[model samples]
Target: MLTLLTGLAFGLSLIVAIGAQNTFVIQQGVRGEHVGAVVAVCIASDVLLIGVGVAGAGALVAAAPGLLTVLRLAGAAFLLGYGALALRRAWRPGALRADPSGAAVPLASVVATAAALTWLNPHVYLDTVVLLGSVAAAHGADRWWFGAGAALGSVVWFTVLGRGARLLRPVFARPGAWRVLDGLVALVMVVLAVQLVVRPVGGA
Candidate 1:
C-alpha cells in the first residue's frame, strides 16, 4: 500500500508539471473538440508507457542512448513547428473565438497533435520509463501494483483537467481569453523546444 501511494504521489508530481502535453489537453478541453478521445489517448498512453516501464522496457530504453538522441531531435523539431503555429495564431487571434462547437482544428489533427505532444518528448521516457520504472522495481513482486497506482494518477488527473475546463467556458466565451492562452502556449512551446536543444534527453 505504501509503495502504491508512493507511486501515485510520484506520478502526479511529475505529471502535474506545466508541459506541452498538459497544455494541449487543457486547450482541447476548452475547445471541447474531441476531448474524450484526446483524454483517452493521453491516459491510455500514460498507462501503456508506465506499464512498459514496470515491465522492464525501461532498462532496454536506458541502455540505448541513441534512441534518446533521435527522440530529442524529433521532439525539438515538432515542438518548434507547433510553437510557430501557436505564435501565428496568437498574432491573429481575432479569427479564433472561444466557442467550443466552433471546431477549428479537425478531430484527426487533434489526435495526431496529441500523440506527437505525448510521445515525441524525451521527458516522457525519462519520467515514466526511467524514473517510474526504477521506483516501481523497488517493490519486487508488487511493482505492478505501484504501476497501477501510477497509471491511475494519470487517469484521474486527465479526467479532472478535461472536465473542469468547461467551468472556464464563461471566461473563454470571449476572444481575448483565447488570445492570451495562445500567446502563453506559444511562449511555453518555444521555451521547451529551446530547452530540448540545449539539453538533449539522456545527455551527460
Candidate 2:
C-alpha cells in the first residue's frame, strides 16, 4: 500500500505538467481528430517508461553524469522551439477548422509522435525512470506494487484529460473560447520552457 501510494504521487507530479506533447494532445482532442488514438498512445508510452523506471534503468541513467546534461539541453531546445511556435499561433488569429474532406491523422504518425515525445523527453526519463525508479527501488520487494500504482495514475490522468476535453466540446465550439484556450496553452509552454532553462543545474 505504501509503495502504491508513493508511486501514485510521483506519477501525478510528472503528468500534471504542461508540455508540448500535452498541449498537442489537448489540441487534437478539441479538433475532433483521432482523440482515442492519441490518448492511447500517450497512456501506453507512459506505461512503458514508468515500467522502465521501476525496472531500475532510471538509476543507471542517473549515475551517468554527462548523459543527463545532454538530454537536458535537448529537452530545453525542444521546449523553447515548441514554445515559440505556440506563441506565434497565439498571436495569429485563426479558425479551428476540422477538414470534413481530409482523412484523419494517421495512426502511425500518432504513435510515432507519442513515442518520440515520451521517450526522447529527458524530463520523462528523469521523472519516471530516475526519480520514481529510485523511490520504488527503496521498496525492496514491493517495487512491483509501486510500478503498478504509478501506471494506475497514468491511466487515470490520460483518461480524464482525453475524455474531459471531449466533454468540453460545447465550450470549444465558441471561437473566443478556443482563442483563450490556445493563448493559455501558449503561456503554459513559454513559462515551462523558462522554468526548464533557469532550473538549478542538476535540479531534475
Give the poorly placed runs of model 2, Cα more than 4 Å off: 98-110
Question: Which residue segments of model 1 deviate by more than 4 Å?
Answer: none
Worst 10 residues of 2 by lDDT: 95-104
lDDT by residue (tens digit), candidate 2, 1-204:
877888888788878867867876777667666777778888888898888888889868878767766666666676666666656655665634323123366868756755655655667777778878888899899998999989999888877787677776777666667667767777776676666567833585
- Candidate 1 lDDT over 1-204, as tens digits, reads 877787888889889978999998888888788899899999999999999999988888888888888888899899899988888877897667657656677889999999999999998998999889998998899999999889989999999998888777788888888888888888889899988989868666
Residue 72, candidate 1: alpha-carbon lDDT: 86
Question: By how many angstroms RMSD does model 2 differ from the true structure?
Answer: 3.0
- lDDT at 174, model 1: 85
Highest lDDT model number: 1
Taking all chains together, the TM-score of candidate 2 against the true structure is: 0.81
